[model samples]
Target: MKKLIFLLLAFLAACTSTETKKATSGSAVIINETVVASAMERIKTSQPGVDQTLLEKGIRHAASLWREEDGNPSDFIEFVKANYISDPVRRKEIFTKISNYMESVNGHFNDITLDLKKNLDEAAGEIDQIDQMYGNYSVGSHLSDDFFSNKIAFAIALNFPYYPLAEKEKLGPGWSREEWAMARLGDLFVSRVPANLNQALNTALGNCDMYIAEYNICMGKLRNEEGKQLFPDDMVLLSHWNLRDELKANYANKENGIEKQEMIATVMERIINQDIPEVVINDPDYEWYPFSNKVMQNGKAIEAAREPDTRYDLIVKTFRAMKDIDPYNPEMNTAMMRKFSWEMEISQEE
Candidate 1:
């Protein structure tokens, strides 16, 4: 997910800034222009030959489109239907246009809250019906918005297919623009401010704790507690494990400014390095297991194709490492290999 990548980017930047402007003196807003600049530089440096001029053009077009269709509710629906029948090239162009509304240069964090508040209302109205029919509604900042199908911003999030799509082109898992922004703030904005986190392990743990709390608050605000939650249980659990593991891995490399990385690692060790692995999303062996009996028994273990993700090789290695740490744990060692083989079998049959 881009949200996770953003966090990793922040971790990589590791430029802890303390530029805060005080309103009354008790607290201050740390809109570190230096941090933003540095972060942007890091991103550009990593992307190799990404066309800056082209990206800007794309973002501007998308914002213009949203602005033009601003008042109408049905516009997005028509927009989605158009995409459903679209070929890859068309889809790319459409999303390139949509990307403008969310480009980092335009102002990644400015008025972000207001932007989401406005868009959430639009998303809520559009996604409710889609959710009822497709099993993936209520996935955006708004209660009814199905972000996965609504905009290119959310669509690109499927850069790594988190799950194996069942039927026709289905939605993937991730936070919406608003959700992504909020999490970015927690990861980049809040963590950079002068705090105890950069000093000692406890302080670092404190920062992680603060991040987790802030994350919950953001979630609570964006996804109302009493509202109907639509994300699949297994998917949600996977996100939890993933976020936990990411934090752990990020914290593990404590050179330079990564002193706080251990706190996350400490917490995750509690989660994963347990006596008995716990079930995630009804699948007890989901996180720990290397094989799925269903897949193995079906003989898909020998033939299922590996799923696509952020980086196919990297994902496989991560799973392999998980398996390696406890080679005796068959769940860890053989789950993905078997499951992937099975998936291939089903695909061929269809």
Candidate 2:
């Protein structure tokens, strides 16, 4: 039975992975060998003391991102020649300028996003479905597109080439603050997700968050199989975090702690399995017996539809959206790797 369940879970995972691959795969501009060689030669002659290997890697990385939309090969060559700064002093000055500007940009974008979604984010008011939908809409989804279009992203890529996490962990201790900042700057352009994909991801995550936030279980409406009231009439618990925490708190209830814990676990299982009735969710209009998986309205038995696989479907959508952006990133190719190893700084096995 456990093997069967594992296989079922694996099958679902595979389905989402396939969907993500389909969404992300595409043809992109290839910077050929000739272009790389020419650029390398140009940089070496023009900028003598600059590290040759770093120059090669930086130019290649920048070239990989360049599209026909940006310009033809000759135009790309000219831009590289014009923009490549050899003098260490001048390069540091440019980094300082970029760092200052980026701080301002980051601050303003954060303020804008917070302002746009303040109502939905706050715990104060009764947010309807419409508000949830609007909150899902991202105001800063197109920032990457704008940056790439304006050649600012290309400039950053050309100057501060990214180093992998492993490299950083090994070398970071010896690095100065400014050097560390430059490494972080390099990290920004390592991946490119199109504006549409960004919007889709933001929407999926927003929906999931809103659903979880509003999934309040009216503790008053819950009953055991024998029709015994388990919780106080006015007490409510949000699923699944608050509910889980409440269950944890029940550990000190030495008399009925195990029974209460079992009951909450059953409710959580019902929710995760998507077998919980729709009417019981966030609705105090119905009484529910989770163990029996039954519902009642107005002291009479009533039928209700099972909640749709909304949580699972949202996971799939998020995966697909992330997968769409996979091609643009070479180093951190998959979303899972990027999230685990890079963002969370947690190893996969752990």
Candidate 3:
């Protein structure tokens, strides 16, 4: 279930706002304060009795996302004038329409992804390179770009401006259901990452998932001191989740539980340090003594190669992929910041 969730997240991460041709960071303020004030005043003059604070916030937010292709300051003012909604009834109707459209788009894309990932996620026979490619491919990757190109994203941003996490935490209790939904919708187009970068991140995470899925420890082959197997024959567990779960379960076993726990710990340490025998990993042909890090095959001890830091290599690959996205995200420049502040809606200190 965790693996499936990870896979799903990897696919969804590819659906961020599409990159602009300029390649500037989203954090850079494109519209100046003068233009923002002018746009806000123009909207106020056009629509009498409009909420001044919300109008300014919405105009500024929309202007921040405007690019060279999106037109100049005069065009931006015109866009705000045209798209800004002052009437409550009309605003609600538009919000509902946008919500329904987004739901349909997201649902169909998710269905397509699930179908593509079936072979990789399920025990549906041998997985080919094509399966991996399809599983890693994100159908919604270009949705952001298309929306921005058509000015749909800008329209949404203009009316439904985003609130900071701190601001939300403070005022969320007083917000209505529609307000909450609008806030979430505002979050959809905060930054524009390139489609290629999103695809690279998806591939990196998918490769990590594949590596972990195939990493199984043959517990029946793990021999302790005095040449005894603690686990039953044919007992196999995936590392490190299953291995950790089995170790926790052994705590109830008063007899030989400590020995089993120690053996599992040793196995974990070997895995972390990249000294685990290559032949013992997902291979039942060799007998492994975790305590001494020894490998024996058919009653004869043999020199076995270590895992060559493949674990760390994959981790680095995923890290680099995330790092490549940092410059595009002005608010959350680092991956950790995005995970905690943007995704988790909390600070690491909290």
Best by lDDT: 3
Write down the TM-score for model 3. Answer: 0.90
Clashing residue pairs in candidate 2, if any?
24-324
TM-scores, all models, native as reference:
0.17, 0.89, 0.90
Give lDDT tens digits, candidate 3, residues 1-350.
57975885686455443443234544355689999989988888999999888888788778877876778889888888999998889988999999999999999999999999999889899888898889889898788778888899999989988787877889899999988998898898877676778888889998988888789999999999788999988899999999999999999999999999999999999998889999899999999999898899999999999998888778867876786777677667778888887898885752
Cα lDDT of model 2 by residue, 141-195, tens digit: 8877899889998898888878777788888899999889888888777766677
- Candidate 3 total steric clashes: 0
Put down candidate 1 lDDT per residue, 58-106, tens digits, no spaces: 2222222232222232443333223331243554564555446446433
The list of candidate 1 runs beyond 4 A from truth reads 1-80, 104-107, 110-350
Where is model 3 poorest over a 10-residue stretch in terms of lDDT? Answer: 14-23
Model 1 earns a TM-score of: 0.17
Candidate 3: pairs in clash = none
Which has the greatest TM-score? 3
* Candidate 3 lDDT score relative to the true structure: 0.85
